[model samples]
Target: MKKQFNRMRQLASQTVGRAEKTEVLSDDLLQIERRMELVRLVSHNTHKRLVSCLQGQVGTDSEKRHKKLPLLALCQTMQDGGAQLGDESLIGKMMEVCGQAETTLASELMEHELQIERDILEPLYQLAEVDIPNILKQRKQLSKLVLDYDSARTRWYQATKSSNQAMAAKVDSLKDEMEEALNKVEICKDQLSADMYNFSSKDSDYASYYLTLLESQADYHRKSLAALETAIPNIQLQQGQMGGPTTPPPPITPLNSPARELTSTPPPQRNGSVYLTAGTPHSQGGSRGPSPHLMRRGRSSLHVPLKGDPRGRPRIRWEDDISKLALGRLGIPQDEVSSLLELFPSRPDS
Candidate 1:
């Protein structure tokens, strides 16, 4: 009975030891699973953050630089009239920002992924050392974990590829937009230059025309003043001659008197014409009337002067004689001179 009791106690002690060792193994497995879960949560959070950053929710150096680049370029364009702005500066800044963000995110993701892998491997090693059955069961779980990890890794890789592709596309789009804007600016500059040139040309033409008009007006006024100056002296001389007074005349001489010859003879009444008496031997007949030839001759010799020449002013001669003038000057032939003179009478000056 004593041997059997001792055997039973030893058996219970062995069973208790076995239970304790199993409990310890279970605890270690649970710890390892908890650690793996923690690692998964940490990795997931990091991946979520990285995705958010890639999706533009979390700002990175690339995002900040992209946001600031347009504003900086706009300010520069405004300040310098678009002349000093360039695409090189903007593109360089964009590349720098993308590189920085990529490096930082890649480093962080790799570190977290490595840590999770190490943690999962540690549990796998411990399970191998313990119960072979537990290790086998955990191997199945580990295979699932590996699949999940592979899925996560694939997602990360796909996300990285998509992010890089999106970034490249965005950069290309921005470059195209910038190039179009620059072309518009250049067109505006050319238009402004053309307008300025036209305005300057018009102003110069107007100035020249105005100066020409002024010179023409000045010349006209100068000619008018000269004509007035020449006419002033002639007007003054005419005024002086008209301002003088009139004069009286003298009486006739005694030898030219008519009353002394009529006392020696009685006058006889003849026909209507007057007849002069002749002395004794010189006269053919005292009763004969005046000769008809003498009367005709006296009538033909009578001359009448022009009405304005009552005081008998001397005639003013022209430089050339009208009768002896050439046909070209007189505008008529010598044979036709009488008819031309009848049509247009010759003036005393001509």
Candidate 2:
């Protein structure tokens, strides 16, 4: 189509010579094409919000009908539902080792979001969708070849001011169409000023690849805090072997506190009439036998308060053949026959 109507009439004569200021360009190549169109609109919205934050998905047809899991695949589906609801308990093995340390920290955060989408969003989407839009489309074809070399040097100075000898062969064909439109605007202004000085010298190597993507996101959060500090000592040793009532109890014993005194004997108070004394080694002629403080308070069974017994209530009698007697027939004193057979306490027959 006649070269798209002569490139839309050379973009409407360079938009009427840039609205009459007569078409411009070099304000340092228009401030490096407005700082490369603000670095291509901030690297095309930072490579579409970092590929929708590493595919945790905002696919966008109004959130693509909403089904997007990814908190590390919901932490590996809560570590396979806490290892199938924790079989060997201790709080289900501390929720199956804290969901297997958050599913190995979500597989090291999905290999650190696939190494930041392969080294920082594919080189910032190849410099915002292909090298600064191919250097702003070769600076709009060198602004329509500087408006076709100023409309062929104004028709070769109006055909050399018409002194007319048949206008000197139309002024030598308008001086070879104004020297072929000034050699195509000096070869597209020397290849768009060498691609805007090679994109300002690679902008410091793209800011050191964005500081190596923040040092690989601080080494993926220090390897997810060293895998939750190695699963917190196996969840505190399974909460101390699943212990219970967790502690604080045993002190009460009060309610008017008196009773607990009896270690046994209290019987042979002769003048008070309570006798049954048998542990006799020999307390001299007084015949007082069971006394070295009741033979060092060892024996126990001694409820002896029987006198005329009209049920005055003190007849406890469990001597049960005192283990078939024979410590030399109970003349006891073999160092009190093991405290009289430990105060004789058996009672089978009535």
Candidate 3:
């Protein structure tokens, strides 16, 4: 008897519990429209702010020589270049955000559909298959019982007044069963109303939170852009100084001989001097000209660098033919070094 009573209560509940109306889903997509609008608005605001932040800026012509440029203008050019780099880089980041926004909305919409499938549509399918048909069968059984009860009661009263009282007693029992079923249906309907309202309210709250998420993303990008604007100048300064030291031409290295031998030969000098124009090995046809070592040298004076040589000093050999001379230390030639020393008396270092 208890099992029968519980089944009866269950049937009454299922019959009265109408499909859960997802009024949040049913509302004419106003919330979706609002969210999409926010996306557009945020994108426009981001682009506008980025443009305004890096607007009216000049860039340099790379083909032009930076050395010919003034220091102030060079610094300015580097600064502008850094700002341009930051702007372009951040614009790319903004584009990434745009792509994410578009795809995220698409996924959110798919999720909402899945939510509907999981929460409302599947359970309603169960009602259609089992509960609804069961309720229909119970309603038909009650209708047939009503007719039978009426016929039985009428027959007992008129034609068979002496008939058994069980016939009338069964009709009263069926009436009580129908009354209980009606009360259960009323309670089930009330519960379904309360439950669906709460579900719709919660769904709307989730949608509101989705809007908050978009606002947060936009805020993050804006802060990053501000940081970039401040940091690019120092990067410009570093890049501007990336070029290393400038190198000058190498100095001339003097050679003393006709042969390709190392020598230290000094350049020729002319001055007011009265020297012997007589027959001397240094004189030529009564008029003396400076030696090849003095005029210039047998080879170039410029120090040619070899691979393994550490010191780049000039390898000049100034005492070329002087080694062949048989002069002693005490018997020096007056027409040579001692003579030149006497000629230029003031320059001892030279």
Candidate 2 lDDT: 0.64
Best by lDDT: 2
Clashes of each: 0, 0, 9
Candidate 3: residue pairs that collide:
252-301, 253-301, 253-302, 254-301, 263-316, 263-317, 264-316, 264-317, 264-318
Error (Å) of candidate 1 at residue 78 is 68
Best by TM-score: 2
Candidate 3 per-residue lDDT, tens place, 26-143, comes to 2333343344345445544543453343212213222232322343243445445545556345443333333333333333333333343344334434433443344444434443
Error at 256, model 3, angstroms: 53
Model 1 Cα lDDT, one tens digit per residue, 1-350? 64345334444544566311111123444454444444445534544453433322222344453344433344343434323433244433333433333344333333333333334323333333333333344444443333333333333434546657765455545455445544544454344334334433453543443355345446545654555465555544543454522243555645555665665454542321221122233355444433445444422332212335445433333112332443444344454543322332122531
The TM-scores of all predictions, comma-separated, are 0.18, 0.38, 0.24
Question: Which candidate, 2 or 3, has the higher TM-score?
Answer: 2
Off by over 4 Å in 2: 1-55, 58-71, 74-76, 83-91, 103-119, 126-131, 134-136, 143-147, 150-191, 221-227, 234-236, 243-350
Reference-based TM-score, model 2? 0.38
